[model samples]
Target: MTNTEITIHTDGSCLGNPGRGGWAATLRRYEGGKEVKKRSINGGVKHTTNNRMEMTAAIQGLKKIKKGEKAQITVYSDSRLLIQGMTDWHHKWQTNGWRKAGGKPVENRDLWEELLTVTDELNVQWEWVRGHAGDRRNEEVDAMAADAAYKAA
Candidate 1:
């Protein structure tokens, strides 16, 4: 609401590829390049994929923006699939009726659609960060997600 841009860092963790999973998002608002506000949210499920948790983190993070608050958002994640899908691949998939180039249904169509809906409500930019590369915020969310996954398990 203050016209200050908000940045969100998100991560997801799974015990196994298709095992208990968790996701986390940390949001920050900066003014004059100084962080003025911060909040974190996390959740987990007994059965899910890392990809699903990754998308969930982004969706839940974006949802934290208050309604009617029009602020530019930049989302950072280590998941290339999440970032690339949202920034590039989703358009083609949508145009092709949610099917991949090979005529196979997009694996996470539901989450993709939900992400699109949430993103449409705001101005968003996607950024990819390498996981475990020492980015402080990224590392924080990574730990948060891992802890959540363990708790869920």
Candidate 2:
């Protein structure tokens, strides 16, 4: 069976650093070089951080793929922390028992572990997009996240 191809754009918004926050993800599937299917998901919490929301977006987006489905997924996000953590820091953190430099336990370990679990079940490539710079997909998720945050407020 041929592996499916999917692109996911994710974004997060926060009204306050530790206040209302939301996350959004947009998933598009391409078949035969043509757009085939698309979906958007979003949610928010009464109190959260932007980083947490960012990671949540990624986790939610990846979860859309069914278990054991074969797919090549490219995940796009504006948060450097999310991208860097997945591509780089996660290894070191895992090696050190989920502790960061200076021996501080990794912030957002729950979300980080969830993200890792979802990613491990799929073939995923991480991409960083400059947020609010006119990337249509990225902007769409950003708006969705902001709207969700406002609604949750």
Candidate 3:
């Protein structure tokens, strides 16, 4: 039996911060070359932030993975906040009991908790990419997210 790894490219878009948003994720199975399974979803909260959209994208991406599989996964996203928060800030926050510096409660604690829980369930490698840098895969996810945001509005 061969161990298979999967790569997921993700992006999120918002028409206006605290207005409309969309999220997209593309999963490629590493068996032959790159067999893709793409997913995009969007919704306008009437008042939602870009960071929320970005977080939503990550959560949605992780949700797509099948259960009970020993798979190595890489999640690529353009949101530095999402990547850093997940890999770095999350630990700090947890140590502080989900509070920010000065002992203030963390913003978006619910989303962060969900992200942490889901990520912990998977063998995932989180990566950050520079948005709009003409990276084809990145750009494709971005476009899908943006389109979903528009159509959902």
Candidate 4:
């Protein structure tokens, strides 16, 4: 069977550094060159940081995948922190017990761990895009996250 191709676009927003925060993800499934399914999800926390929200967007997006299925998944985000941490720092962090340089614990380690676990289960490709550009899907998710944050405020 051919591998299913799933594309998820994600974004996060925070009112303030330690204020209301929100995350959004848009999932699209393509089979045989035709789009099959699509979904959008978003949520917020009463108190959280932008980094936490960024990690939450990725985790929540990956969590939508069906279990026991081998799929080629690509996650697109604007957060360099999330993209870099997952693609580069994850291995080092794992070896260091989630600590960064100077033995400092990684922020959003909880969500990072969860994202790592979820992405490991699927063939995930991490993609970084410029934010606030003309990417419609990214813009949509950004708006969603912002609206969710607004509601939580």
Best by TM-score: 2
**Worst ten-residue run, lDDT, model 3?**
36-45
TM-score, one value per model = 0.95, 0.96, 0.88, 0.94
Tell me model 2's lDDT, rounded to 2 decimals. Answer: 0.92
| Runs off by more than 4 Å, candidate 1 | 1-3
Which candidate has the top score in lDDT?
A: 1
Compared with the true structure, what per-residue lDDT tens digits does model 1 show for residues 1-153? 335789999999999999999999999998766789999999999999999999999999999887656677899999999999998999999999999999999998999999988887688999999999999999999999999999995
lDDT of 3 by residue, 66-150 (tens): 7555789898999999899877888889999998778899888899998877777679888999999988989988888888778
Q: Model 1, residue 68: what's the lDDT? A: 55
lDDT of 3 at 69: 54
Sort by TM-score, best first: 2, 1, 4, 3
Better candidate number, 2 or 3, judged by lDDT: 2
Overall lDDT per candidate, in order of appearance? 0.94, 0.92, 0.80, 0.89
lDDT of 2 by residue, 44-65 (tens): 8899999999999999999998
Q: What is the lDDT of residue 140 in candidate 3?
A: 85
Cα lDDT tens digits, model 4, 1-153, are 555799999999999988999999999998876789999999999999888888898899888897655768889999999999988998999899889978999887788878878876578889999999999989999999998888884
As for lDDT, the candidate ahead, 1 or 4, is: 1
- Number of backbone collisions per candidate, in order? 0, 0, 1, 0
